[model samples]
Target: MKQNAIRAALAAVFLTAPVAGMAQETDLAKRVEQLAAELEKVKAELAAQRAQAAAAPRTAAPVPSTAPAQAMTNAPVSTAWATPAAALASDTVFSGYGEVNYNRPVRNASGTQTDVRRAVIGIQHRFDDKTKVVAEFEWEHGVVSASDKGESEVEQLYVEREFNGGLRGKAGLFLMPVGLLNQTHEPTAYYGVERNFVETAIIPTTWREAGLGLSGEFGDGFAWDTGLTTGFDLSKWDPASGEGRESPPGSIHQEGQLAKSRDLSLHGALNWRGYPRLLVGGSVFTGKAGHATPGFAANDARLTLLDLHTRFTPGAWDLSALWAYGRISNTEALNATFVGNPTPVPSSFAGWYLQAAYKLWQSGDYVLSPFARFESFNTARSYAAQPAGLGVPATPYERVATIGANLMVGQGVVLKADYQKFRQDKSLDRINLGLGFAY
Candidate 1:
């Protein structure tokens, strides 16, 4: 029994010893795993701290870089705020331009070849957003007459007051507001060598008188212009010579013989500008020449005019057409007295023109336009002539065709070259080359 007990006890001791060793090995493995987990947590925290340090800005860094990325994203907004204020403070609202041209006539039959076609200086001042003034002084043909004895004259001096809704008023010595090419006559504004013949002989462009005018736009792209002005007379009577002439030596005057009579005139126009590429308008005017009525033979005359003007511009092509009719009527007794046996007669006139211009080169600062124009005019439809020497009768129909080019060199300056062929009934063909400008 004692031997059996000893062997059993020894087996029990071996079994307990194996169990304690396995338990110690398992506990050590568990502790090691916990320690490894703690070490991984510390490493991750250190990496995060390093990343933050790398992103932090240095004190010496540029201001732009030091700013937070969120602030930097709003830079465009801040930049835009300052632009308008600076632009408003230094706005360029006042500007001016001028030109001086020297032209030599080619084949001018009138023996009037001359230099210095036109010298003009123009100035524009914007007093505010709505009021402006434009003034131009012109020296034409080096002092008007060929003798070079007179002084240069002021061409245009006008003040423009603009209101809301395209309403405006102009006062002072401005263009007559009669035709298309009259008010705007810069070399670049018109094609061809010069203005059409109808403008020169019949209507007489650059015809301005002292006047006050109002112009405004209505609804639906319609506009109107009306004015009150001094009138003009077709004939001048010299008191010393008793001769009836076309115009006075200095200037044309409507009040003849009767200084007490004041002349009156009216002008109105309607324009449609709905089409972006086209502008069409019609104008009319009525004028009266003040004269004293002599006995049974009335002396006063009445003049009436009607005109149509159209402009079409598409791409690089430009076209214009104009027609005008005019009439002058005198009293029956006056007509009979002037021409011994005249029963009753009324004088009338008509004129028309068509022109086209094309842009040859449009790129860059310079432009070239080649153009052609056809014009015709008649001076007499009703007339009774005095004897041959007393007063010459009005000239008959005149026709003209012109070809020319305008070269624009930079802004506000231009060079014009054109040839005009004029044909009058029972007269020689005359050619004229003219250069003119506004600014």
Candidate 2:
């Protein structure tokens, strides 16, 4: 009986062993199949990614870290004045420009001196692809204190919105699209140690106002700009001081400082660049200046400015010309208030300049440009009628000629030397050496 039981048990064990082995084989096969399916899925995903990358649009590779400055140095000079039309940089960008100078009066050595002319810091923050904010803070001279000639001010503060079809609008303080330099007058943007007299004295370089403005660019090489903004305040005019004699608009310019919005100004500009490396444009600004300020004598005063400018860059040559004329109406009554002042309100002022620059030499990121400019301006061209012997005679046009050379060390750093000759006042002639940078 014991032997029979042992045989039965052995048979049962052998039978179950085969079934268990089969189950193990089935489980192993299932795991292999699952792993194979996962491998195929990964392969499909990688192929899709490769195809998408191939179909994507090709973009120019970014410039190497060392090439940005070199590329900017070689860019066309017209790009320097992008202003409101310039595209917003991706993310946040920091920029700045400044200059330090040494001036020696040719006739008086005692007047020789070296000083910091200006330092500026600017920020551009992009909230999205189409909206951005820009601001610039500047310090003039070196120090800003109660007794120093230095000052701190906002050069620009504005928010810009980009619309469909190359149109852009900006509000807050912004530069007027008037002259070649007003919008892009960084130290590295121009050829001289100092700005041209016509732009600086007549049109007021770096002129800006607070208001709304529109700018548009077209595919046909045409651009347009228009704006309504705060204007010069005649109530700020000082007849006793010679400030007005130096720059009529600069003296009375509100600069958005507690500006009087009672009077708004209109400005418009049109530009054409149909030809290669050539640009021509014109601008006009007109407005009432009195703002109905209480006790102001020139309530009816009207200010009008007109300008025509052209620029051409051909190979190694750069040529530019500009003419500007300004007039203030109803100034006769205002001049009567300045009976004893030698400098009275002027009815009209005009200026013109012609400049030429040659790319004399270039190597790597270094360039040398020699330039010459001739300009004529009359700040006090014609004063209003005053009582006998009370009237101030119109000053003769002052002619100036500047010869200079600019040495560019990198993308935005320059060393400049120039000699200025004054036809009206030789005593004002001087030699200037300057170092300037922008980024």
lDDT of each model, Cα atoms only?
A: 0.55, 0.80
Superposed Cα RMSD, model 1: 29.2
Candidate 1 residue pairs that clash: 193-418
| lDDT of candidate 1 over 258-292, digit per residue (tens) | 32236667877777766675667877777765444
Off by over 4 Å in 1: 1-112, 125-127, 144-151, 233-261, 291-299, 331-346, 384-395, 425-439
Roughly what TM-score does model 2 have, to 2 decimal places? 0.82
Q: Give the TM-score of candidate 1.
A: 0.64
Query: Runs in model 2 with CA error above 4 Å?
Result: 1-90
